[model samples]
Target: MLSQLMVLFGFFALVLVSIFWINKAVRMFDKLIGDGQPAWVFFEFTALTLPAVIGSMLPIAAFAAAVYVVHRLSADSELAVVQATGYSPWRLARAVVVFGLIVALMMSILAHLLIPNSLSQLRMREDEVSRNVTAQLLTAGEFLHPAPGVTFYTREITPEGELRDVFLSDRRNPGSAVTYTSSRAYLVQDPAGTRLVMVAGLAQNMQQSGQKLFTTHFEDFSHDISSLVSRDAINLNKLAFAGTPELLRDPQAVAARTGAAPGAVMAELHGRFTAALMCLVAALVGFATLLVGAFSRFGVWRQVLVAFGLLVGLKLIESAVLAPVLVTAALWPLLYLPSLGGLALAVGILWLAQRPGVWRRIANAIWPWWRRARGAGA
Candidate 1:
């Protein structure tokens, strides 16, 4: 439990750091868009998106954390006593499963519950903000700049559609300076569509020395303003939102919407299960590698690299090859073959870790593939 807690806290910190780095880059683009909001606004907006980030991060965090904890104990010579006492490698691996279960529960909550609800709320709040009235969008005392060439200042705005004093300057025009002020003004939307309709109690307009100024007050003035939203609509039925249960029950529906065959959902659903099961697989792989070779003495780094390589290879294959098969083989579980392969590999590794001479047989089969991987990486 303590290990689990440590890993969980470390994962959260990792996610926070990643989000901060992403925000640093996003803020630069947001500044160019001139949203009349501060950097903190973008920060808050980005921070609320952590639920989406949590799901993808969980598996990698679990794998890295498991490797880190296991290796650190070994490096400090803690595992030597356990091994000398006849604590089998399998028993040692069982301890890691305990931690894996904790991570799995956290992943399930983030993937199936928290993320979907948060995404729904985020979309709703975004819509509300975009539809907000012009008065709500404007600020008092400070010059509000929403675009490169537009500046707005309002002294006060009341809930009852009254503005105390207002000033607007449009600096986009080269030769002339257009300044407008009014004692009291109110804003309305275009009755026809999405446009701003401004109506004033009194008005004054000045232009650069083109014979005096024009004053108008009797009724209304109107202008067009763009809506303030950045992202596309967030629909919850995407593969990520379906969760494991939903995906299992309605593979057809998922296929239709996602344009993948039934195998895609089957693949993804099985993939998630397989991913959770990696705790067992990694433990097997790590233990097997460590036990067989006294001379080869492949340490923690080798164990980590082996696990990481296998995990990444499985993921890349699922994305690049199996993902496409989903569209062609909707009814059949073709995508699940990879998951089956992982399970098979795990079982084989466990068997070899127990039996004599199995490593030589497996090594002969696996060596060529290892060489290929090394070559590709180079």
Candidate 2:
């Protein structure tokens, strides 16, 4: 129960930090696209973004938090007392790993299934907003930019789709601009249900060629623009798609990308295993490293420094390796290699710290070699 509570709190802290990080990115994107809404609306948007963030960061956060908690317990000599009472570190680590497994599986579900569906829904909502909105509600000027490239101006517009004094400038590129002016224009839908048609009573246009410009006029014209989206399910790209089950179902694709066998899907299939295993690895490393510096007594700040360095270094290497493995070899080295390495390092360090005779011999082997060189120089 205590371990579970710690994990829950750790997850909460990790989520808060992730959300704060995302808030910065969200504000920047909002400014870029001018999608700012009221405070309540922004809060809602952030809430929508949370599941995605949790899906991505939960495992790492769980690992880090587990490591920290274990280290703290060890530092306070709590582990020694527990062990005196016949509770082994490995046993505790098993519990941590179990917790990690649960979180990992939940994350996979969110990442693979929930997030994708939510994103598609959000897109559909935005599309509906853009499509059904009236030109007057969207723009109120002789010239208005509803979207980036299209410029529209109207002298008169009626609720019944009658548009008079319509002027449009399409600046899709440089050195060529198409200008259209119609005495009257209206929107019409095709019975085929394939397209929306814009019918015009009279139309005029000016086409530009370098420094030269040519103009033309017509009595009737029509225009059509494909809808923003058609009826199709969106695919979560390789990076964002989560869940080992789905990845396993399509083994050929994953194997082709990573050069690994279908069993490699276990990484995604058992994300919690990976995360909990990572926590155990980190706990072993953190405990041993802290003990090594115990006499020096560097304290929490020092532990924080070492932890930050180790975590950051591991992350950099993992990200660098993950791309190639997933892209070409189908080997997920990033997911497992660091975990293994951490575990090995932790075990080695713990053994060395516990066995003083072994440490002395190892120290002597290096010191004598250094002294021989100094003696010769003197």
Q: Whole-model lDDT, candidate 2?
A: 0.55
* Local accuracy of candidate 2 as per-residue lDDT tens digits, 1-378: 246435654776577657665766577456323432334544555565666666556545655565566566656777557756965445554655556556556655675677756665555544543443242222323576545566767676677757666776767665577677777666555653322223443333334555666666566666543332243444334322434465657756765565554444444444434554554554445445543333323345575567567766766665565555545434655567776777677667556656657877877898999999999999
Worst 10 residues of 2 by lDDT: 132-141
Expressed as tens digits, the lDDT of each residue in 57-79 for candidate 1 is 66666555655665665676666
Query: How many backbone clashes can be found in candidate 2?
Result: 6
TM values, all candidates: 0.62, 0.59
TM-score of 2: 0.59
Off by over 4 Å in 2: 4-25, 28-45, 67-95, 115-149, 153-167, 171-204, 207-244, 253-288, 291-303, 323-327, 330-335, 350-378
lDDT leader:
1
